[model samples]
Target: MENVEESLELHDKYQFEVKFTYPLDKTVPYTEYNVETFMFIPNNLCVNHTTYTKDDFYSDMQKYIRLKTPTMLLKNILNDDKSPLKALKEAMKTLVSEPNNELKMLDYKYHLKMFCSIFKSALRDETIFAEKLNDKEDAEDYIKSIIDSTEDIVKKFRDLKDIIHVPGLENKCYALYLFADEFVSLSLDKYRYRMIFNLDKAEVKNKKKIRSELIDLLSAEIEYRKSARYNSCPDEKSDNEELIYRESTLKKLMGSVLFLKTQTMREGIYIEQIVMGLAAGLAMAFATAVAFLSQSKLENFTFSLFMIFVIAYIFKDRMKELTRIFFHRKIQKRLYDRKTNIYNSLNQKIGFCKERFAFFKEKDIPELIKKIRNKDYITELDNGYIGEDIIYSKRFIKILSKKCKNLLDDFNVDGINDIIRFNIRNFLGKMDNPTRPLFMPIEGDIKKIKGGRVYHLNMIIKYGMINKQDIYRKFRIILSRNGIKRIKEIPLTI
Candidate 1:
């Protein structure tokens, strides 16, 4: 990460750092990742020559990637009359400018999805997305042809890093069509898209103004969207009422899915209720009752024996199992109801969207943008934030595993599987921070690393170096905070 940071600082010309404000000892979302031990962790940032924290930086990157970068790429595509992105740009404009027309929305969505696919492929192999214009007649065909010509994914993002040219560094001016869709995730997941500038410091008053302006721009955009959405109601309808009515039932249910999934801190399948194993408990209870009552000759003795039996068989042990099972079932039922409702609602919404070529209403796009763009900036870059450069350590570790094919991309640098390595991980830096994996660049990077070094893998296979199967042999990777250092190489015994 430090190397990547240095590369960017010189290439992108911006200072980057990670904050340890949140205790590295505490169990954060990245607990299992052991990521803290190997990679950097950031609580804040100073990029594009401004300042930001986790939340604000994430929001800014999301808008820039989905809107700004894509829009710039469209402009790049327009330079060639036959570029597929031209169709995309036109569709995007139609989607944003027109009212809620499902047809237009579908067109834009389709184009955006294809554009992202091509963009991702380009990142893997560095195939220039803007080349070979006037070759294909249809946009999809053009994109498909590019994809078809490419070899399987090559993880190096040489062309991509050039596109997303650092928007910050205050004084740097980046070229258009340089947006690399996967680089944001590369920086963020590795905890590299961070800085040490505190917006409250008094020395950075000038830089603070720029940061504040961008933050204010984000905030204002959000507030504007809220107002627009609120004011978009037709005659006789209030904004609040209309807004609620506009959201499909599926959206509400899906929103509830988030609530249900995390309601418990348990590892997986949050057994809200246990629904199995009850007949045996009941049988044991009945058998014990009958046996205790069968001895009637000595009333006191029978009662004592019965009490002992009940305590030993039912109350002491079986009852706990019985109670747990019953309660688990109850929770299971509750969760089942909510989950079923979400799925059913989702199906219904999908049906509706399918029935007609539906998309966000035209009025809704700006409002949505306003709402998405607008957000509160917790740490403001005020005039007080002026000072000398602040330096912070950034940890970067490299891992290479063959049988553990998924380790790097599917897992973590610290050897923790991704299931436990929480914290919003994505090549996309994901929009809205749902902590999901929409764009996975880690796996691609792993594929690109050859002979313990990060880069393309052309020589290893076609050039007759190591066999493709030899790449997956097992080995021990000694871990460190300074970075991953080769301790001892253990060849696969098997």
Candidate 2:
């Protein structure tokens, strides 16, 4: 199952998280390698008229987008039947009982890493879900559940630490304890802010209570962090540096324990390079032939012969460039822009993700895409008057389902999360002011009114899987000179 959530991030950036879940139960027997996504930009806001180019778009994407290593979903980690935390606790018990067993010790470390990474992520997911709850009762329940779960987990960690007298592992145990404490504080802090900004006035009392509880949790976390065992600032750095140091240390620990690893490389780069080399050779052959023919005909060092040679050189250069461009375009048509390989913690390859980007004219767009765009329109006159430019992006993902399911013997692992954040700063350069003054007649006298000037950039994505019906989603991104104004989902009825 594939799910996507989209929202605006910062002021000029749009973020979307795509969750690819591989279910353990018998169902569709196909891979998700045929997904295609498209974005339609107004001509005035595109490279055709503005200064933004394909290179700029790609650069911005690289800066903003993030592809996190695939891990188990929060629900899966928190599942009562098969919890990583529970498994971790059991592993710890065994390690403490038989510390000399190297294989058992390694198993304990693996479980510890899996629990820490998944626990942190699951808390984040749960907190976000809690904040989005509309029912006050549900919100209260979720908040309480989070607090109870964290407190119980922390207590268990403390108990385990008390028993862990094994030398050379104090730092690891203390780090896990601190990680749980700090993450709860951070997640609750975020929840408190969400309640203040997102919840309604009717829940003022409940919100206040939640806020108070969150503050208490944060205070406890702070006190725990300041305890003697876990130093707040060992290096005696400034406050900001101390916070950075703690976060950096925690991240390093997490990296060490993470199960999945990823490596990205430019797709088809070698073959494309070879194709370009062949193109250059072809162009050079033509140029050499021209030079030979010119030399033979002239047979003298005269002005005419010099002119002929110069013309041949110019044509040769032009021919090489033209041929190179032609071959590049052909390569683009056949290959993706980038490829990412996914590997297990054991350094074995499991799956790969491939993505491509391109520009398309209206005439070149698919009929279904055009239909989705023109839905409910009174006429085609708008398109005729102001033709839009289309930007196409595609993803081909392939995962070994059995490998992911068997990642952890305790529970089935969830698939990858492709988090893409796109910045629209490039599209804002050519936009007019956010508001333009308009003169209007008011009671026989002319009055000025400030009218909003905005542009709409539509994006339509097609999600495809073998033997499964494709799903389509369209979004209208309202923009101004300042940045993105808002994004509205256009429902598909056809």
Candidate 3:
């Protein structure tokens, strides 16, 4: 399962923690801070906000599988005094519903890091667009959205900055969150019965088993920490924005705008140089005409006309260059202006979004991931997970030449067939280890090498095993991340 920390924008891809922190400030210390944190229940904010635990969902899933209304079944089951599954239900409930100190800390840290992360992402998005734009309307909606989202983002960011600060603290919080999320995933995996079909579960057990164990280790860390500092002392910890990063949003935006202006300035100078060359050529042509008219002699007049022709000929390319430069610059600026307008609007939107972070509704960003469980119980209702298994399919789309077909064709002319008959298994044995390629025993695509072709069949290692005797083995292996499948061989070049 992917780490739950990635759900928040503050973390990197599959990362849970921030590299730096703001010193955590509280009335006493960590204990007095409000502990309730965000929960991950995709697309269903109501569920995320509620007190419902994973065990409750498990019971609901069982109802879903039985084709009964979950609400109705839950009501009836809760009232029942003697159900065989009741004890198991109660045990799973504690895993989710019980107060876990480590989990609480994770929730708190994520909430804080997410505020800063979202803010930076929005700002960066707007700034990148601003450079591409030259007109107003293209970025109209995008800018509006940024502005609409910014204020609420910034307000909450301030709230987070006030308390959560420590260089390495966010990393721990993210780690804790991952462990907690993974534990919950494992609980759901049990209901899915992923291990039942895997005969190799002993060697490659379900990933959830390891995730559960990790959560145990993380929980132990918090449970055994030196609580004496927070519980016994009344010292106040002060946090400030300076603890995290130095640059402000406005400063970053200014830097981007400056860079765009610099490019425009260089383009303008190049156009100016083209214009100067054209002007110099025209001036020389005019001077030659004047000199011809003043001399009046037929010979001198003819000479002056020839000189004018030479000047024009010499500047022919210059004239063309000037026209091209002027036309291109005009068209480019026109296009750039349209995009610039959009980016400016987007920039404004981001600024507005940043300023008002506190008042926005929670879950403003709609859920992108919709699977609620391993089996996605909402859509797959009444269909219990049966799991999948490794199966093979084969294909042979390519054929090798007669010379390449015989593994011993080039090497052992006298005993080529005998060599295959005696040590064919040994050649096949070499193919078993994926680190080395299966030697093609023929030349191919010689341009890649310095001289003679030393070709090796390009087979993917993780796909499956290959054998040197192509006449005996005509198919190749196809595999997914789970296990190998067989595929028919495509034609191979000699």
Candidate 4:
């Protein structure tokens, strides 16, 4: 199974996160996902093959895959009977109980790191959700729950720390403990400010109370981090160095547990070399045939023979180039632009992914997609006057599901996340000024206004998986010469 989520990352960048999941009971060890994005650019932008080439697109595009964030709810993680906290506590207890088991020790450390990552992710989601709540009571309730759960979790972690006396694991535990503490404090502080921004004047008392509570919590963590006997930083380091190094180290450790290693290469390199060789051979055969025919017709190095030789050389060069171009196009249709091999930390290859990009003619697009794009327009004449150029980008992903499951057997890791970010600054070069002067008559008086000029970049993303129906999403990106105004996702009924 596959899921795709799209959002605007920055003023000029668009992001898409594709998640691929494998069935637990299925015998097949692999799953494939195919995604195609067709971008329809306005004609006024003058975006075409000459203006925006494949190289230009590749330069502005970035793609990478990482293990999906484990799903652990903030409320459940701390207070539930069968929670991730309980699981990690049990894992660590087992490791401390059986100190001789190397595998258990490694497993315990893995769970600790994973718990830190899961808690941070869950915390971020909960805070964002709480901030977005429309009802004041609902937001207050949610924030209270977050505070309560975090307090419970912190108390439990403190108790759990006393259980870990093993010298080897103590340092790792302390580092992660500090990391989690800092993350919780920072997230709560940010939430406090954002929620305050959304509060009205009448809610000043409630806002002040909320801010005081969050600040108290964060201040306590800061003091604990500073005065703890097992300092996360070395005594020889200065305060600033210790702060920067500690943050960087903790982030690197988190990334080590979450991100996968990948190796990329140009796809079908050998086949392309072979195609070129064959084209050369065909050209050589033509040249030899011409030489033999000319010698048989005119014996000496005369004007006629020289002319034939010159013509043969010209035709031979043209034939070789034309043949190469034709066959390369054929090859591209069957192959991809690049292939990436995914690997785990142990250097075990998990799977491979492929990607391609091209510009498609109107006739080449699918009927369904074309109809969907034109559905909003009332008449066909609209397309004639305001037509769009189409750009197609494709991604094919295949992974050994069993391998991924085995690597993350202890946790509930469902899939891999393929994140793609594309910058659209290249399309802005030919754009007109952001605003134009417009004159209008208002109540029999002449008035002038600055009318905004913008372009519509309509995009349709088609996603498919094996043995499943395809999914489609449409988005319209409004852009001016300055930057992107906004991105709107259009609902799809067909």
On residues 1-494, what C-alpha lDDT tens digit does candidate 2 reach at each position? 35433333333344333333332222333245456767777666645523656566667664212223335545455456667767877887787777778887778776766666666666667767776677878877777777777667656545665545466554665455556545434444445455445444435337777767767766666676667344442243455666667666765566465435788888998988898888889878987897788788888888987887788788888888888899888878999888888777667776777878777778888999888987335223434566777778787877665555445555444434454567777777777788989999999999999899887777787775555667687787787887777778888757
Tell me the lDDT of model 1 at 122: 36
Residue 79 in model 2: shift from native, Å?
8.8
Name the top lDDT candidate: 4
Q: How accurate is candidate 1 locally (lDDT)?
A: 0.28
Local accuracy of candidate 4 as per-residue lDDT tens digits, 1-494: 23544343343433333333433222467777778889998766778887888788877877667887777787778766656678778987887778778888777767777777777777778877876787777777887787787677767766776667557555755556556555444444455555555454323336668767776766666666667632443344466675556566665675567788999998899999999999999998999899999999887889999989899999999999999999999999889998899998889998888889888888899999987786455323434666678999888878786677566665667667776667778888888899999999999999998999887788898876756778788888888887788778888767
Which ranges of candidate 3 are over 4 A from the true structure? Answer: 1-114, 117-274, 298-494
Candidate 1: segments with Cα more than 4 A from true spot: 1-83, 89-102, 109-117, 127-283, 286-475, 481-493
The digit string of per-residue lDDT tens for model 1 on 193-266 reads 11112223213324444345434533443364355343222344445654335333322322221121111112
lDDT-based ranking, best first?
Answer: 4, 2, 1, 3
What overall lDDT, based on C-alpha atoms, would model 3 receive against the true structure? 0.27
- Estimated TM-score for each candidate: 0.27, 0.73, 0.16, 0.80
Root-mean-square deviation of candidate 1: 24.2
Q: How far is 300's C-alpha from truth in model 1 (Å)?
A: 6.5
Clashing pairs in 4: none
RMSD per candidate (Å) reads 24.2, 5.9, 32.3, 5.4
